[model samples]
Target: MGQAGETPGRPDEAGLGARLVALGGLELGEFDAVPSGPAGASAPAGAPVVRTGEARKRGRRRTHLISAGVAVAVLGFFGTAAYLFVDVGGRSPSAAPPPPRKSYPAVSAPVAVGPQPVDQGVRTEDDLHLVCQNWYHPSAPRFRGDSPHPILISEDGGAEVDYRSTRTLNQAAFAGSSAQRRAWAPEPRRAQLVACLDLTGPGRPIRDCTSGSKVLPLVEGKYRLTVYEVSSHRKVVDRALTGADRACPFVILSSVGDTLFSAVKDRQLYDLLRERVEG
Candidate 1:
């Protein structure tokens, strides 16, 4: 029973199909009383209706995917941040300030100095000439001979020699004792009998020079000595040729290595010295 404008409440033709529909708990002959017009919306023909449980299941799956994505993004952000912090912490303290740039002193060539000797424990003559040791310090009156000669020392303070009498004969070869040589080592090479230092030119002086020879003199007495500052053959040449006439024939050069000549206990230079004596 259906009206002209009314939909069916249930199908009139019923059979096994209706019984199967009933078993599924669905009323197959019944119609939903929904208004179908242009104003009211309805499902289009041949469209499937989704159940509330299936829609809920799809919504749950989408929510789970979104949550997993958020978790992965959060983990990536924290991991990157942690790596940066670790890298910064592992670095050394700002590279040690570049090692303080070495600063060196700027210098050119070395300077050249003249010939000079160090002044330590050096002695000087009465005239202020440099001497190496005392005449009577340890070894006095060094005399080398076949037999030891009784050392005859002068009565004066410094052993002065007479040039005129000492040079009359040849007595330059006789070397003194070891003790006497050591005592006279500080003073320049001098003659016990010779007098006067002749400075004539700029080469080696033609003095009575001796190295390894011996000579015998007829007479032995106190004689005038001429002391000269000698270093090498060249210096000896320069010294003998460059200075003015000295005050005494028996003279000694200044120990400062200067080209100056001076006199010691001379009868002319010192009024106190009547006669200079030497051993």
Candidate 2:
């Protein structure tokens, strides 16, 4: 059937019908009616359309990517935090213990000094005046029922000179046993006596003297004596005195001003002298 004015279907309509037939499983009747519109006003032909299934699949893939990125970031943050906690916590190798506090010895208080020795006699020799004193502690212990005595000699009105015994002569000479005597003998090549001489001028006194050596007359032997000069520190005399003269018993001979003075001691007289001097 044909309508005279419609012209047996428009060419555009025929093309649309042909396109509907070409589409797989689409019937021509389904798009047979087309709304009349300006050709340029409709959606552009052959543009790609997004299907629901493909859109949903793309959205899921995007969500999975975003979720994976977030998980990775979260894992990195937590891993870094855990690493920092372990490094900083407790006794790590990086953090060493404080060095042990330096331990110092305890300081002790100063000790108090006791009384000093007292001077006794004043004897004059030419231009030189001498003072000899005995120093002994009042409460000192007795030796063999006798008190111990130490002597101090001062020459030319100077400071006191202490004579240190090189060997334990005074005590050992009075020892009751022969074993003690052998033990108290002076060592070989060692000084037997030591005297500190203080020479006084108008200024400070000088204390510089070499040690002296003496062989006990009771024991026959050769010995050397050393003398020191104060004005000029020269070894003026290095002489040896050898003799076998037995003039005085219990005598301690000492040289003073080119003459030998004997410190004589007998048991009865010595007790009397000690009593008088000590008192």
Candidate 3:
């Protein structure tokens, strides 16, 4: 009953589809394209669709791979920074540090020698001049006759030296003797001599020398004594003297001579004498 080339229900169907579209429904063509269940059975409306297992697995793998790459990049940056910090700023292993400084006790002033003239009986060489003298007495009775007489001597107007007389002589006789009498003659069997340079300054002389325990026959020869600086306990002088020097004076008086003579080359004796003299 339709006209040629016209669909029988086409116009009516188009109008109904337009009316549905205006009501916010799907287009008729789109609605028909939605798949139905098995054998084209219609599914229940408004149901949520779940994703497949393979799709979920693929998504998780991509996320994990991206996280691993980020972690690696961050670790590499930190490692490079740490390496630069040590290489540019640190000290070398072979470099040595400075040594520590040493300290010492303060030194006292030099001792002043005598204004009195040395005894004329005391023998002297033309090259030497006597400056000062000191003596130490012996503590033990057996050593009473043996005393130390430290005589300060100047050579060629240079620094002072200590010439110690190791002898037992009568002080009164030696002091009172005239030039011709020769009363101050030292006993050859009981006399010897030793010399050392005075390291202590004026008024602070440190006498150091060495001698035999018992008197030996006086053989004219050179004897050496090592003198030490009292403050630092360091050796300052090593000197020698001859027994034949006539100007080298004998210690006066047996007891006084003994008191003045003990400290030479003897540490205990030196300490005792220092205590008594200083105290």
Candidate 4:
């Protein structure tokens, strides 16, 4: 049977062409029927192609999804890079400490000037002249007795200031010798001491240990010299000659003694005894 409303028989070939021409209003021999092959027949020409709405919508959705996926990939790539950078170098830098200030010393007080009268120590060697120019302090205020006291010199211990042979000792040792106070001095008492000083102190039993010094130091454990008025048994010079004085020169001691030792008592005892001996 025919698929359409035709009789179930092979159509006459010449008539078939004419029938299709009449139906389709085409020329009679425009289409010649070819024999059917094992490959089978194709669809008739000029068929209308219709598509479903769901299929079109599905295609559009797939395009939009692909575009969105690409955008998400770009965003995720930048996001991952930024996250890694922040994780690796997220901490802030620490600040450093400052340096210390510069340093220096403080200023000192000013120096003193003028003559220091207070007995500082012994005189120096530079001022050991024939006459002392800087006799800052004299043992006594002034000389008394209107008559000059010629010194009656005597000594117990000391290498210097000898009374035995001053003329020979001066020429031998102390001739041109330059020392502030020579431990071996042989100065002339009358010539050296042009004046006298009162060196009397609180009477104490003193030991004149004036050994091997230029001046007869009033130290303990040495010589003993006692002067008295011959006419009377009165002791005129009973005081010790342990020279520990810190006063100015007695004109004679300034020439012999220095900052360490002094002969003020030596000169004082000489004058006190000289008055009794000569008079």
Sort by lDDT, top down from the best: 4, 3, 2, 1
Ranking by TM-score: 1, 2, 3, 4
Q: Number of clashes in model 3?
A: 27
- Which candidate has the highest lDDT of all? 4
Prediction 3 TM-score vs. true = 0.23
Give the Cα-based TM-score of candidate 1 against the true structure: 0.24
Model 4 agreement with the true structure over 81-199: per-residue lDDT tens digits: 87777666663233234557677787789776533242432242221121122233232122224433222233322334432212112322344434312212412322222221223
Could you give candidate 1's per-residue lDDT for residues 1-279 as a string of tens digits?
655755444443335345434444223322122223222245578644422434434544665677689999999999988777768677445533466778999888998654344333223232112211112211122223332122111222222322111111112113554544323222412212112332221322223312235221111122232332222101111111222223323333222122222222323211211122222
Please, what is the whole-model Cα lDDT of each candidate in the order they appear? 0.31, 0.33, 0.34, 0.36
lDDT tens readout by residue for model 2, 1-279:
855533344557547546534533223333432333333334347643322334434544665677689999999999988778766675555566887999999998988653233232212111011111222222221222222222121122122334422223344445545433332332221211111222222222222222245333232213233332211222333434322232333433343221222222233222322321222
Worst 10 residues of 3 by lDDT: 135-144
Off by over 4 Å in 2: 1-49, 88-163, 167-279
- Model 3 per-residue lDDT tens digits across residues 225-276: 4432211223334544332232222433323222122122333223323221
Task: Give the distance in Å from residue 108's predicted Cα in candidate 1 to where it truly belongs.
Answer: 29
Clashes of each: 8, 0, 27, 17
